[model samples]
Target chain A: MIQISVDEQACNGCGLCVKDCPMNVFEMGSGVSIPRRPENCMGCLSCHEICPAQALEHQGVVPSRRMYISSRVCSMLNRVI
Target chain B: MTKSFIEESQQNFQHDLMFRVEDVPLKCNPPAAELEQTLHGLMQMNGYIIRSLEEIAGRGANAVTFRAGKKFGHEVAKYFQKKDNVEEALRELSYILYGQYSFEPWKPADKDHYIVEENGSTFIYLVFHDCIVRQTLRRIGQEQSGPLCQTLCGYVVGAIEEITGRRAKLEIVHTGPNACLKKVILK
Candidate 1:
């Protein structure tokens, strides 16, 4: 399982990551990208690479995709795997 | 007696002016080294002295934050290595600088590379990252073309340097043609 962590301090609340993500793994809320569906992450790193703030991290036995944003936002896009 | 009175009045005026306004020199524009030097100067002016260069690099942020008072708060700065390694990928560094405009404001439009935002006194968000063009290259492969790589490399390096006044070295970790791997490293 991949653990995605967005650095609150680093995420600037830009919605680019949410827009770039093809899996719909991220969504914009309170000016930040929250992992709406972590399982939906294709591990393509689209969100991770696109994030301007470099605020995403994925830590696990197999690190897949980590998207870090620069702000602390409400997680409104969550859905069960 | 008149001369003495004039001199006293002049002193009183100077003291009053000093109390009324604090003159802080703008040190935003300068080379990386020079900026660090100016930061040191500001610290000394604030009565804190630096002992060595390593100390400056290691804790320069703290010294700067301290001297700027409440006018400036913590801001993040990132650095990258210059090499052609496929393993270590570059990550974007963004953060909010807590405080009012103690330093000059970096306009989001002006910062075409990174997305910069200021939400009142809450924080200033600076978005730093590469876009699809560079990511496409990275995803496709490293040994694709020198011109392409150089251009991409220059963009990423230039963006960070312009923002932080620091130098960075970039490495191309992998070169894949979006097909079967031509070359593979065992690391």
Candidate 2:
């Protein structure tokens, strides 16, 4: 079960997420982006990543654990950060 | 009117280019049963190696996995070099990848929408509706599988290069938990 929310205050209805989503999960309405088909969301995070305003919120979506980042790499990144 | 010799030859060539694994030669000419068993075993080993490498190398594992996938694709192209057309070779390759490697039921994007042709250039669009890598990532609650997807890119590019004797470009156009679309352009 994927839950998607749009921040009307931040979203300018750019529709980038609507265009970027392969599943057609977002729709533009009243100059704002809406999660019209939240049920079809695959939790790919493409919308979240593409939203310039960072106005989209996804809940109940399990984060992917396929990161190949090892502890050594994380330590190095930690030091850099 | 009788068909011209060139037209007849073209038809014959198309017929010969039909996708068939049997057309691919094996180093050891194994029987069908034995070949399937060998492929299954090889895939199992591949999965193990990928997992182990991901665990060992961490961030660098994707490069290794990409190279491995490219090598695998090159090997397949070497075995099936009848026609040098990139589209035909890739279509056949997709059949094998989806039929063999997918852990869940797979549905291909509509063919009419899958291919884009313009100005004598060919672009193939593929959507993996249910990828094993994404499934694994989701199950484990990890946020980064971009590297894993790179393996597919390498494999497709390698196969295209080997088949057409020319390099091709691959782009990950869109990715989702349930679907990802990859675009391969023949250059």
Candidate 3:
């Protein structure tokens, strides 16, 4: 199961996550975003990308495959990061 | 024969560049390093080409890619035996579609599909995992559900139509970074 948390202090009342999430996983309450249906989250991370406030945090989601990145770049990135 | 100075220089240059001292070995599957580099370059080039096509030709580019994907879909369906029903047909597809790109039915809460009471319509949802198209778009930071995504839409529609011998359409319900949810409607 995936767990998502919204930082109320960091939330700027932007509803981009609510509007962009394909699964209808988030809803607005008191001008803040709420994870109305966390079970439906498919872990596409669209909400995470669209959020300007970066108030959403999710855990326990499978990371997507990383084969698309070039091997050289990945090797270089691995060294530092 | 005496050692040729030119040949020695060529070998040294090739070694310094980390290239094969001799000509690249010929093989159907060249090498992982070369293949990954080619795929990465191709995806970036395709990203640019697709964006340019859309910018210049608009929907024309989509029609072109959709048709190409449809042809590929038809070709893929030819390899499998036809099934009696849609479920069975899709089950056949799901059976073979795996590896680098995989498809799985979205059965949230164990509900296989959604049924509409008003007209008794049924909609089957499929989540595409490890999609290469998504990977390609993401590599260039392009938006999802764009024209490139249409190729997959056409492919699903084509494959389903051919396998089930019915007219089918695939709709994008949501485009996420990792996976995408699509609705398959057969007529």
Candidate 4:
């Protein structure tokens, strides 16, 4: 199960989430984004990440995490920390 | 003012972005330090090859990714074929994959992996808190990337074929930014 919430106050009705959602979980309704097919939400954060207004919130286990740091970056961090 | 605004937004974003999964079963293999080291080397080599192919071929990266994954799976099967049954071999392979992913400095600390058997079928579940492929797609503003998932499917299917001598069906049961469930059914 997944939960998607859009902050009405924060949402600018940009429709980025509606367009970016791979599952088509959202729709533009009355100048706001509605989670029309919330059940189909895959928990992919594309919508959340793409939202310029930071209005969409998703709650579910994302299948994989992206944390790529090069060895050069690691060494730099080591020096800094 | 700009910094404060950014900080406030960050705070709000962090407060709202809550993810929870209940009592996920952890099926982990004991560390095989020597074997892990070897697999790590192989993966690094494969990574280099895949990247080189992608560089040369551009859009054909998916094919290279799938072929490399299949070859890697076959190699894993060949290595463990003599010592263990199909299920055990897969479990071991799962461990190696998990280890390889976790060993990366960029991987999320909370990511998890599991292998379970149900109704005479085996399931390998990998939970990625943040998938690189997803991130890449998002970065490029692409709505979907079937090839990325296809690469994984090819690997699992190839491995199953090597072990059982039968092709397995790969199904994506769930997809989320934080979690995706792929099931490999031996057929």
User: Which has the greatest DockQ?
Assistant: 3
Q: After superposition, how far is residue B42 of candidate 1 from its true place, in Å?
A: 53
Per-candidate TM-score against the hidden true structure: 0.26, 0.48, 0.80, 0.51
Q: What is the lDDT of residue B155 in candidate 2?
A: 76
Mark the regions of model 1 whose C-alpha exceeds 4 Å error after superposition: A61-81, B1-187
Residue lDDT tens for model 1, B52-140: 32245544543343233212211222333332222222222222222210112122222352222234211222112222223333433
Q: Mind giving the per-residue lDDT tens digits that candidate 2 earns over A2-81? A: 79999999998899999988778888899999998877665668789778999999998655433222455567999999
Give the alpha carbon lDDT tens digit for every residue of A35-65 in model 1: 8676544344556666789998755422211
Residues B18-136 of candidate 3 have per-residue lDDT tens digits of 56588775775776666887888888998898899889988788888788778878888878777757678787767545554576667465453552222433467787877878888
Full candidate order by lDDT, most accurate first: 3, 2, 4, 1
DockQ scores for all the models shown? 0.02, 0.11, 0.63, 0.20
Model 3, runs deviating above 4 Å: A78-81, B1-28, B31-34, B107-122
Worst 10 residues of 4 chain B by lDDT: B101-110
CAPRI verdict on model 4? incorrect
Using DockQ as the yardstick, the better of models 2 and 4 is 4
Error (Å) of candidate 3 at residue A72 is 2.4
Please provide, for model 4 over B77-156, each residue's C-alpha lDDT reduced to its tens digit, 9 standing for 90 to 100: 66555323544656555654563332111112233434455787655544334444444443333434355555666666
TM-score of chain A of each: 0.66, 0.81, 0.79, 0.76
Residues A17-39, candidate 4: write the lDDT tens digits: 87766557789998999998877
Q: Residue B78 deviation, candidate 1, in Å?
A: 52
**Over all chains combined, what TM-score does candidate 2 have?**
0.48
In the range A1-81, model 3's lDDT, one tens digit per residue, is 778999988888788898888677889999799998888877778788778988889998777776677668878999999
**Regions more than 4 Å wrong, model 4:** A60-66, A69-81, B1-52, B78-96, B100-151, B169-187
